[model samples]
Target chain A: MIRRKILFIGLLGSLFQIFLGCVPLTKTILSPGSPEDLTTCTNVFPVGPWESVHKIEAVITGGVSFSLLGVTRGDPNKRRLHSFLLTPEGFILFEGLLGEDGMTIQKAVSPFDSPAFAGGLMEDVKGLFLPPPGKPARWGRTADGTRVCLWEGPDGFETEFWEAKDQDRQILLRDDLGEVIKEVSLKGPFVNGLASYIELRASKPLPYKLKMTLLQISP
Target chain B: MEKTRMKRFLFFSIPIIISLLSAEAGSDQEWASLKEAAKNIRSVKSEFLQKRILPILTKPLRSEGRVFFQTPGSLRWEYLNPLRSVMLQKGDTIRLYHFSEGEWKPEMTQAVEVRRMVIAEISRWFQGRFDESKIFKNLYVPGPPVRILLTPKEGVDKFIRRIEIFPGTRPGVIERVEIEEPGGSRTSIEFRKTEINPNLPSEIFEKP
Candidate 1:
């Protein structure tokens, strides 16, 4: 009987590992391209501490939908207005503000009350707007000719910002093992200094996504 | 002693119960008549002014829009003021569009269930099924325009404080809706130039 229990336990452990293996975040050798390429790739992006209030409408594919008239003010850390309405009819889904203190969920409906989902959103927002956390680990180009700058964050987590010719910028946050955790892409032109559209995709936890559109920006 | 306590409970409860029954008798009749009248409306088209009050703001933000609703689940909510945004619900799916840069782009609106539920409730109002709705408990208020106060009956009650809907001179036509939020502030949508059962194009429900 004990032997059978051991076998079942081992099977469960292996299945869990396989589940974790499915998230795709691959790393490659730093592409040492021309000096001009590195400057162009990293220069187009904005450096923090930027503050703006954008009328954002975001939807989570099969999960959630809401429109936000929010004020996003932040500098060294991210400050976000956690408010949204389940649209068409204007049903309020959540109303709160989030900062370094984690998510202060003043109002949230069921399923959205989870802290991790909000935390993941803040992480994505920071990744898209604010410059990467630390100094660039390597400033180079990708094999596909996309200019890429990799910033080594704490705890083996790295953020990569890449901008291609005539294309909007893209950001990748990866774990130490080089597995991609979050993929964020900016669409539309940088009006003044902010992009009008942003899409975030997370591989782990669950297949989650948020598409954000900018309405207005201010000082 | 037990018998005396039982007698005391019945004596106090009877008057309270009687008053409650009398209130329901009057209220239920009003609701039943309103629902019966609403049953005749097939569609509605109206222009609305929507104002939202957020805590972060010093003043109420203003927006202007038009709303279209059809019975059995179809709607079009278009905002054309400070910015252009369109929301449409057909069957069980919801589609959103926003004008950005120079053209209209499709927005991801996959939260179909919530939107569906809300649309269902709104559509039922036009269909004259107010008393049959699972979302709210309706109370009739005496007014020159006639008013129905709705308090959400379920989890949605957490987000909504109360909804006061005023019907037009024509039976079953809703002219105004004032939705009170949890924070004491409310959003008032006033419908003007309301038309019912007009010849509407099938194309109006299409994605932008």
Candidate 2:
């Protein structure tokens, strides 16, 4: 009976590890480029604080699409963000403040009041406004000549930022198993280093997509 | 000496009581007159400017729009600038639309639910029945511009703190509305160039 219990516990642990994708898989590496290449890649992120309004179209996994007015005030230096969403008729759906410690939600209506939804939205705000966690682990040009800057997190996750010749940018976040979990694309006519259009897609937690169009950027 | 003091106290208190009673009576009289005026209004059209004030923002977000209403339950509320969207209601059927890529598209999502609630509230205002809300208790204040204050009851107080409505000099016209939220955020909408008893086309309330 003791042996059977031990076997059962070990099987459960292994399954949990696999579900978490804890085993780090090898990712592709490019040529080690110069310092100027790193600067060019890092410049894609905004440096100063900014307030902007966006018209957002969100599509959930099951073909549920809705529109919202998004207002955000982000300070990259402080790594703090205040964001809220409003319905067309001006009812506030969600309002949250994200700081270094965690997220504090002031208001959240149904379908948006879940903790998972709040965490996912905070992750997206960080990805879009702030730079990666630390210094770049690798900076170079891909085979197609796209500028790439890769940052590796302590959790065995990797974030790669790409800038094309036309100034279009793409960010890919990979989990420990080297599978892309979140993808973000930015197209410019940038205002103060902020993209005029942004699209983000995530597969983890749930499959969702958000397309944001710039409406107003504060001076 | 005690009798003299009592007489003096009554002399001051009686006028104060009488004035308070008259003020209350005057408020009720104004309310009844406003309701009587609403019966003559067949339609109403107006331009509106909305300002949303929040502690998180340095400046209030502004939006401009238009509102149209006809008797027997038809309303068209359209936001023209800063985000183009419209809500049309004719009787029980309500439709929502958003303008994208130079065209209006039907919005069949959860957002329509929020708009429907707003339309229901506006419909009550158009009917001069602002004091008839089951969720709020109405208090009439007779200002230079008479104001109607609605305070949310127990269950609904979590979302809304209060609502203030200012009626126009003309009957059945709402000049302004301010909705205050529990979290120190407020939305103020002011109406302008109001036209009362206009002939509204039936097609204006149709679906997008």
* TM-scores vs. true structure, each candidate: 0.58, 0.81
Per-model i-RMS: 12.4, 13.4
How far is A186's C-alpha from truth in model 1 (Å)?
2.7
Off by over 4 Å in 1: A1-85, A94-96, A106-116, A132-150, A162-168, A179-181, A201-210, B1-42, B47-52, B57-114, B127-135, B140-146, B152-158, B169-171, B199-208
Can you tell me the CAPRI class of model 2?
A: incorrect
- Colliding pairs, model 2: none
Name the regions of candidate 2 deviating beyond 4 angstroms: A1-31, A143-145, B1-26, B97-114, B155-158
* DockQ measured for candidate 1: 0.05
lDDT of 1 by residue, B24-143 (tens): 323677777787787777778889887655555445556788878776677887888655677777777777776655567675442334544555566666676667766567667655
Total backbone collisions, model 1: 1
lDDT of 2 by residue, B1-208 (tens): 5333222222111111112233332367777888788877889999999988766777788889999999888999999877788889999988888876566778765435555656766877888877776545566668655777766544444456667778887777889987776556778899999999889889999955
What is the TM-score (0 to 1) of candidate 2? 0.81
Q: What is the lDDT, from 0 to 100, of the residue B118 in candidate 2?
A: 63
- Assess the local accuracy of residue B119 in candidate 2 as a C-alpha lDDT between 0 and 100: 77
lDDT of each: 0.61, 0.75
Best by lDDT: 2
